[model samples]
Target: MADTPQNQAALALQMYLDTSASPLGSALQRAPMMNIGIDEGELATLPLVSEALTGSQRLRATHAQDLALTVDVEPDPARHALVWQMQMAQTGEQPGPRVHNFRPLHIALDGSLAPDLVIHTWRGGAQQSFFPPDAITPERHVLYPRTTAFYQDGTFTIGTHGGRSSDQYMPYMLITTADDSGGLWVALGWSGNWQARFVKPRGTSDLHLTIQIEPCDLRLPSGTTLQGPAMALGLYEGDAAVGYNALRSWLRSHMPALPSSDLSHFNTWTAMDANVDETRLLDAVEQVAGNGLHYFMLDAGWYPSPPNDFYSGVGNWRVDETKFPRGLEVVAERVRQRGMEMGLWFEPERAYHTTELATQHPEWLLRVPGREHALVNFALPDVRAYFRTFIADLVQRLGLRWLKWDFNIDPLPYWQQANDGGLAHLGHINGLWETFDWLRSTFPELTIENCASGGNRLDWALFSRAHVNFANDQYTNPDCIRRILGRMGTFLPTERLNMIYGPFQRREYDDAAWQVLEGSSFGVSEPIDNWTGQFRTSLRHHLALHRATDAYRSGHFYQLTPDTDDLCAWEGWQLHDPETGSGVLALWRSASPEEQVSLHVREIDETRSYRITDLYHQSGSQTVRGQQLIHGLTVGLARDAATLWTYHLVDGEENQ
Candidate 1:
């Protein structure tokens, strides 16, 4: 089941047109020319104007109204992944915004394709059930879509739209056969709201997928060029893990490099919340400097005096001299003295009625007929330019090296039927891209972490340019952390996922430490002074273990266990570096009765013997042949315990 074009299915499209033209077929011999009507007419398939195989396994198609698209397919030996891009340019003689129901991309298979396959979609983000700020639980209330769907067999179509904050929910879907033999992975590259569908034609084995821009009423002026997001489809013939790995490979190859930084972050929000000051921050920097930490971040409330909070003063990005009489730069200097980079958190997309931006530039906010809070109209050229210059200047002047960019609220009542035309949310997202691009270019070394009211904004569209993500606001809840980390890791690099470690005053203490071991970048909210000797020593030990197992950053990932709703069950994952034959496995047992579980490791060379080192216990080392390891390795753990083990190929033992 290699991903070569010869093995993977090719697209044979049937186009519906308004003219006396016959239905276009893939057998046209040459690329065909089809005239398309701008109005929503009888179009059974995508109204393709032209198509060309752009590269090996890649296809490009253009439609009327200057809608250009490129579909790029990359075939791994066992899997074929396809990514498509859409761009719209103005067509002469026609002027207003164009509205059309773009058909879904179709994938047809002969009757030989199996009938037992399942279609899956994510809840977009943790806050999907909540529309505006009112319905949202301020901290950690909802957690159903832990970003997964149960594995089942049977042909069906499912999709999800909208996201953490942007337009489209989550932009990816996973479909797998009942036997896990093979399936397809679909992804969209747009940052704003979008729509996608996975449909298995009734009574037929064919699966048809369609992904298109949403809020289709989005207005683009005549002669204006609007770039839509791209959709990617991947076909693989192995298990879901095999398919996910291929998707990850495609992302790594195409997505922008993560912003430059060591990314060992420390945030104030986890510990101090909105209560922050220069003395406490400086103290935190000095204490954590010796713990192998690299970045110190000033979370919300740093920008204003005691009276200001993250909610109201967000739009006014200014320094509150009351908190830092010597200016924010002094804190930055203190951080630099301790050899740590400085980071500041900001919620730039939202503005409350009390802020200066809302008062002075009311027009910059996206206004719905009835809503109170205004979402910044980043799509507006002037607004984007202003924030770009403002944030860039702040970073440069303060010598800041990192930014914890947060979007706390979702833009609801997005548009009014009577006034706005076209997709306003889209424009806001476009502005997001513009601002991100400007920051990247202006400060090449700056690392920007994406946070949308705690893991709401987790999607590929933002990750392509942003460095790290605030997975969720629920760092204290081990179950929540476990769910987020395990599932999000299916697509995102483990290292790019940001998790917090803290005193865990309200919950189980050991859970926080376990969470720290699982995430890519580790953060501590509490002041170092509050850390007991035992806790501090354990933190240092875990940090050292993470450093040793750093190979996990670039290694291939495999989820060894299915996610369960039960907190008592066991779950685990492995990150293995094929080149070095080294990897790390993390296992956790909640309240489950199982005292010991047998884990079947994956992707190791069967000829080599691997030596497993217990990271937590450090009590002993054991060697097992890779073949035996794959069958199963039994590890004993007390109830509600977590442990990490690092495995490396034993030298001179490869032939064994």
Candidate 2:
């Protein structure tokens, strides 16, 4: 019989070695990249590692030299859509990059993407099998779109579609090898975010996604990469909390509402508060109402006991009766009473080593016959059914308006531990796909937030229903600019902006705000918790900037410079009146610290004279012709402050 796809991949890895003779053989033997091409046989299979992403899952990350690219490969009868990935090891000491999802990368057939076919038991993990719908809605999140995928019908199509952008950087790693017989195995890889793990199978939420690292891989040129599932960079979205009413109420209440769509504005939720008592829970709700937050969330630890320990009885999804004596009703009621919306927390897939969720539904837990990384498997159809019912019921009972969904652990060994296929990582991620469908279909009104410990699992696909990606930043130093981009920008668009923004401290505004919000909005975990001088200025400035300019809040987006030092980087957003041809311009400077920064603006109508005012800084106006503005503007900034400029078109009649 002809060699099976699995055998072909094994052979490919062997050949890859003879051709490249990479010295990193040991590492390759561990986590190799996969590839496909003319040979079709030269694919690499990743050796099964005992350890899964035990501590924290990674989202997208890019640092000095360390690069990681992940692509998704869907299976086919005749062939497969090859996807691959590259992850740079931590280079710098300063929290390198806490990336959650790798950017979505595109590749061609000439040994591009990864190869295809090599399952732990039956074609990777079953998770690779799930897919989501295309439409966007509250039901469909913006940050965690499960349907995000890439494809190729045939090898010829790869070239026919314009093969090899050889000129660019795939500068990551190569994944393909030759067999002793000279044939190459076709091994392709891809990744995604998950709602629940199928490692050992928890509940009946049959959702899964698989990412095969492969047995061997080649290093491509720098910048070489693949776009995979974006579960890693989860950001928190809208809340109506900052000011209730999803409609124009808040804007009308505040000022002449800017004529712009909600490109940012991810609502707020009570983030990461381990409320073990009813009083604490109520306080958290009041806190959400007290602040101007709209999307109030109750993060991990609200269930019963420690959160990370999902299998324990304490980790049950049910509200701790003791703490939530009145159940979620009070919490939701309080949030609504405060004119704020609310979202509850849950980790259904991860049953704790001591919890009723686990004890009663032990069958749901995934277990690799001989491993310690036991987990739940979402591949089992029965499990998916359970999840659907559980979540749907919660939505109905709690009057839950929002959902703060979480996946706190990395799941590799969990799959192996699940025993079902020993491919639970690949299998359980399926839950992500199913979860997206069921969650949206079941609770169409509820907003979901896909979070894997902040931005760890943040990515593009999750956007299907998750409007926001939680970038916890883990309270990292506020001064690190790279932290912002590395965690949030890899896959998202301008729509996820207002979903960012946060409590800015004057002392750390230079370090935190500048780099932290390069691609996101002004989201704050503790908006009014601590108010001081610098914090006050930073907060006021952020509000002024976000509120005044359409770009940061909602407008045509632009990234003027690469992320680097010495060269001041900038992001410009222009809001033009389609009819009047007038609007505001906002800019963010990330270069060197200076009192004055200058830039040439683009897309301005030179013929029309304009009046520009510093929204946050000047509160005044200066008459400058369009020519000077478009070429860039030279403005003074506080040490590490932001500047908002409003360009009011000259009303010929008024001016005269």
Candidate 3:
């Protein structure tokens, strides 16, 4: 069989493991795919000792000093893309030399692939769009929500500042040719601080790309091996959206599957605040009973809170007797009786300075100067064991089916303060993975929601353990929600992307409904008692719409409008299921003055005809040829309005 572009890319990656010749010399001098800094120096300076191919998809190479690197290449022929993962380990009997700044991906592209490349990246923190114009200085250019730079560059770098992987920037990038024809999509799967550097030296066409987990300086114990975080490289042809879809497809196939009942939920934190009581919660549960919400999450305040304060009760894991005299089991039973699962929130990694846990186990705490709360050192086996028992007990006692794991404090200071040559961070992160793995294996039916100050710790490493990610905490602003959904959807599977809706202060019903459609799963934080009859009707209607379009949420997504943060622009995307020839187009007319916009749908069969239905309005349906639909479709909406239009093949052609 002829080698496709994807297979060709895989073969090119195989060259990095060739041992007969120097892997980093002459022919590959511009492309050192992996780098390691040890006590002696960079690993590239060492001679290659041996090379072996385990199978058609796996390659391994051992260099001097028993340092081995492995690459796993999986090709998706349907998408015409190659997904490759890299990991390094120490293979000697004795402990290896102290490793420093281990980088899993270190490639330097020169000649034709360097000069005209365009780099794309996204920011990952909350309220990124709320910054003022004056706040965005040239020095803080990388701090913005998103950036696209045409490279004639000296050097460019994007990375997280704190311990959480996605605290400052997302661990994903897309680099394409100037004309948007072919390039590489890179994603780092580390759940800790990660960095990516693109360096193009002066007067040279070489563009060096490197990704590493920062502060990764540690030595392996005897008979123990240290592995770097996984790095995935996806090669794509054609436009940027093609690259985005390819990466998303790869992630969906690799990551863990989400729970069957996690699609839509209701959170009580925003609604009831810290004053949650058994009576109020039971009433809240009744309000959502058969309202299309699958889970009822009692966040934060359900635990013991001193002075009725949520922040002060970080380590108090038991139910607050004063608020829930009958215990959480009562409410949990009610939720289950109503055909809904119950979820509880817990911040297991932090303890308030005044809490009993912190007072008793000060040695287990990772402290920084002047912080109100101390980070629980998961690196300690005792700590992990305690939490595993504590959490499991509560899950069984309360009949809880889901856990919303929240981490609010930043652990970078403590990790750096430990001064154990970065071993503290490494141990703590690995311990977290172990704990999560234990939970999944112990309770196969349980669902876990990975949240860290809302979306700060999201990455493939964490995604592999948890079911879904909460995008961000800024849910009140429709514009912010829209921007976050679009950016996160670029590389993440839409089905694993979750967001919160309301405490609806001043937002309109239309705006709230639009936000709900943008994500696959959502939780409402508003008090049900405050909902008017009309509001309740509208909420139910929207929830039904969301459930009806489940296929679209998991389908191939394409951004139809310019990726921008401007409030006055029209933004939209299309989700197509190629197998069934069904899809939905969702558009938001933000605050734009224009009422009508033209959208050109992609990946449609030009020879077929489609039945299009307008979901928001009672305008019935229309039949249109695929060629005409792909050419253009004019949609009109008033300012601050949004619409959902779904389409599928006509005349029994959908099966094709």
Give lDDT per model, in order. 0.61, 0.39, 0.72
Per-residue CA lDDT of candidate 2, range 1-656, in tens?
22122322322223223322222122222122333221122112222112113222122323233533222222111111122233333333333222332212221222121123111110110011112111010111111112212241111111000000100111112222121111112212122322211111122111122232221123223432223232110001122110111111211121211222322222333233353455655664554443344555555555666544433543366777776778867776777787766666676555555566557777777654543333555756677888787777877876776676666445544543333322344335546656765776666676665565454443223444465545443333343323333322222343342234443333245432533453454455543344345654655556445545534333223333333333344434344443444555544554545555566554468767778776544757777777777776677654444555667667452222
The positional error of residue 300 in candidate 3, measured at the CA in angstroms, is 0.5
The segments of candidate 3 whose C-alpha lies over 4 angstroms from its true place after superposition are: 1-12, 15-32, 41-96, 128-153, 222-225, 651-656
RMSD of 1: 7.6
Off by over 4 Å in 2: 1-272, 287-291, 306-314, 368-373, 416-426, 475-477, 481-491, 497-522, 527-554, 565-593, 605-610, 648-656
Clashes of each: 16, 199, 0
Best-fitting candidate, scored by lDDT:
3
Candidate 2 contains a number of clashing pairs equal to 199
- Candidate 2 whole-model C-alpha lDDT, 0 to 1: 0.39
Give candidate 2's root-mean-square deviation (CA, Å): 18.2
Per-residue alpha-carbon lDDT of model 1 for 241-275, expressed as tens digits?
77677676666665556555466667777667777
- Ranked by TM-score from best down, the candidates are 3, 1, 2
| Residue-by-residue lDDT tens digits, candidate 3, 153-254 | 567787877778888777777776556666677777787777888776555655567887767787655454344576666666678788778788877876
Candidate 1 ranges beyond 4 A from true positions: 1-37, 40-79, 91-97, 102-112, 127-169, 202-205, 259-261, 305-308, 416-421, 506-512, 527-529, 617-619, 651-656
